[model samples]
Target: MPFALYLLALAVFVMGTSEFMLAGLLPAIAADLEVTVGTAGLLTSAFAAGMVVGAPATAAFARRWPPRLTLVACLFVFAGCHVAGALTPAFPILLATRVVAALANAGFLAVALSTATALVPPGRKGRALAVVLSGTTIATVAGVPAGALLGTGLGWRATFWAVALLCVPAAFGISRRPAGADDGSAPDLADEVRQLGSPRLVLALLLAALVNGGTFAAFTFLAPVATGVAGLGEAWIAVVLVLFGAGSFLGVVIAGRLSDRRPGLVIGVGGPLLAAGWSALALTAAHPAVFLTLALTQGGLSFAVGSTLITRVLYAATGAPTMGGAYATAALNAGAAAGPALAAAVLATGAGVTAPVWVAVALTAAALAVKFAPWWTGSRRPDPIKRPRL
Candidate 1:
């Protein structure tokens, strides 16, 4: 893998921290901005919405620009948004900043995915992608916790300032292109749009959405399940989250090694096990040992399956390399947004915390069904080995 890939991962680490750290900062933000917690939560929703909308839009608009330029511009905009968010005294301005920041985040991620794959051999795209995405898994384990600690010790705005400063080095690193890092010919917008007409690409996107949706359905409610259902103490919440993050890191690494060569095998074994893990968690969450064990296993299975599906999207969208990452990003964000909302609905029905686990099971099962459907299974897929550069 090229060193530039690591720089992209570093950028992702900063952005991912900003993305996930809000969960811990909402209380402080609500009190400071004089808004209800529920209203403050809308910041997350705004970010997710921006990601879903901005991925393809930004990719299309920046199709003609050099990859490095697009990445650096997005990083600077993202950092600027954080600065604005930190200095803003009013809630509305902060909300607007979140939306803009998310747009930049989406753009950066899309281009980074393309660039990462471009930096590697055709056979190692999966590993390259894993290297880049591991940044997010790492952020979950370290960056988010550190951001929360910063928020607790200083203020919510301090976390924002920290994230902005973190972006500086990454942006500077990405601005300098290493040898062999080519600004490839810009992908034709028409060709990119045309790729969406492929049913395989469409189904791959749906699978990506379902896989992530199932994962988030359970993940978003983990705190309540750990404390109320699993009989774990409040302090153990962090332990379970850290355990899950560790498992996810392992899963992505394993997926990287296998997905390029045996995608079908990775998905085949992982898909059913992922659903079973969710089912087990839903049924046995009352047992602390079982809950904790399943937390790790399920996290691994979720990322392994999700990463494979995402790799499939890239393969299926070989005709639209520039836009392929945007499509995958949009689908994942759509799932991320939809999953928590559906899980919240289940909770609103007074279905108890564990009900979301069943939602996860159902979503995973649906994804499996989609993956194995006659149409998808029978369709001739793109050969990633023969695919062209982005």
Candidate 2:
């Protein structure tokens, strides 16, 4: 892989951290801002909704611009939003800043995936995308946990400041990177609409929502889950997050390799593991050992489900890589928003503590049952020789 690709990975890592760090800092934010915990949680919802809108909207607007340039602008916007978030005095101002930052994050991810695929050989595109996208997985291991610790030790504003500082150079690095190939033109609004119209693409995206929605529903509120339901406490949340990320990394690496070897097989295992992991998660607060065990198990299963889902969408989308794949990114953020929103609903009844794990169990089951009827005519040979990319 080109060194520029590693730069892409770094940018992704920072953005993922920026988007997710709020969760770790929610308690601090609630205390400092003097808001109810549920209201403070809207920050998460706002950012996620921004991504859901920004992914498609930005992709449409930037269709005529160079992908690299688009990515840089998005990164710059992301960094600036962090600064705004840090400086904002009122809760509403902070919420607004988070939304803008999330929009930038959505645009950045869509553009990054588009650029990564274009930068590689046709045969290795999947692997290239994996290499660059691994930053997200790495975030769980490093970014989210670190952000949690930073928020607890420094303050929520300090967390945003740190994210801003990290993103400044990432924007510069993106600007310096080489352009993606000119073989395929950037996708326009019409192209994106057409791609969304496809049944296959629809199923792929539905698969993303069904699987990821539940995962996020459970995991997005994880900090609270750890402390509230599991009775762990804020002092230890970061360390446990690191452990969750560790298991997640294992799943990502393994799934990437499996996609290269056999995409179909990966999907089959995805549904089963997703269910198993979340089932374990639902039982997490049942016991101390069970809580820790579920954290690791859910981490692995979620990654396996996510990686395979991305791979499946990319392989099936074929010609409309930018459009179809970008929608998947949108699904990801939308799913994130959905999970927490559902959690909030449960919290209103003072049932919030148990909401996440159970919601995750339901969503994972839905994901497993998403039954993509045999669309494949078994036309393509399952040749290990023409390996899927890294």
Candidate 3:
């Protein structure tokens, strides 16, 4: 791919890391802000909700701007949000900061992806996007863990500050890219909106929710799952998250490559592996090694299929890629927002942390049903999208 894609990918990494770092800092935020742990959790949800709404709202107006410049502007906004998030003293203020950050996150990913797609030949769009998006997958594996560790070892405030520092370099890198390397001239909004109205896009977005919900269910409560069900030492949860990240990073890389060749197969079957892993995790929590392996495998399988799904949406969107892309990000953020609460609800009822695994299996099976439904037929063709955070 071109140097442009890499730079956009790096900028995306910083944005993704900054947004998701809250997971690692939840406990600290609760204490610092004097809220319940559940309330701290809401912060993440609020941010995701912002993404879900902002993805389209931001993309709606971005059609007039060149893609690279749009991406750069978003990064600048992202950095500003992080700066506010790190320094804000009140919980409500932090929430506001996160909301702004989420909007920027949505814009950056959407633009970066739209640009990445244009940087390559039409036939190779999926593969090209995978390379740029690898940064996001890598963030899941590396950035989140490091942010968590920074909060644990140093302080939660330090964690946001560290991510903020990352944003500066990310914005600078993106700003230096060539002016029009990935800018396409097509007006994609109307076509993309029409595609979004299709059964395929709706089904795929639903699939994203279910798949992400399952992954989120198991992964979000990882700390408690390890301490309670698995009976593992608390010390190891951080290490396990990092290990899960490793699996996810590798999975994203492989999935991107696979999607370029066989997206339908990859997305159709991806949940099965994720379901199987989550099932194993719920059932074998007493077996520490098995539990960790299941977590790792789930990370790889669930995430690996994302680019394939995104590519399919993009291809289906035809002339309109931005809304198509924004829809995926919206779906993704909505799914992520749903995961923690869903899993927490299950665990709240004293079903143990495994309640979510059951939810995951059921949701995955439901997604499969829709994926193989009669109406979902007629589109074996590869598709495309615009930029939005995953």
Top candidate when judged by TM-score against the true structure: 1
* Candidate 1 per-residue C-alpha lDDT over 208-271 given as tens digits, one digit per residue, 9 for 90 to 100: 9998998998988899999999999988988888878888888999999988888878888899
Question: TM per model?
Answer: 0.96, 0.88, 0.91
Q: Give candidates' CA RMSD values in order.
A: 2.1, 3.4, 3.5
* Model 1 alpha-carbon miss at residue 110, Å: 0.5
* lDDT score for residue 155 of model 2: 82
Per-residue alpha-carbon lDDT of model 2 for 41-152, expressed as tens digits?
8887788789899887887777667777788888888888888888877899999988888888888888777677667765655576677778887887889878877887
Query: Judged by lDDT, which candidate is best?
Result: 1
lDDT of each: 0.89, 0.74, 0.74
Looking at model 1, report the run of 10 residues with the lowest lDDT sum. 381-390
lDDT of 2 at 198: 58
lDDT score at residue 253, model 3, on the 0-100 scale: 77
Q: What C-alpha root-mean-square deviation, in Å, does candidate 2 show against the real structure?
A: 3.4
For residues 1-390, what per-residue lDDT tens digits would candidate 3 score against the true structure?
Answer: 787777777777777677767776888899988999988887887788888888888878876677766777787787777778778889898888888888978977776666677667766777777777778767777888878878889889887777777777766776776745445465646666777677656776887777777777767777777888788897888777877777877777787777766775687677677667777787888889888887788778877775677776666554665566677777777777787677778778888667877777766777677777665565534334532211
Question: Where is model 3 more than 4 Å wrong at Cα?
Answer: 179-188, 378-390
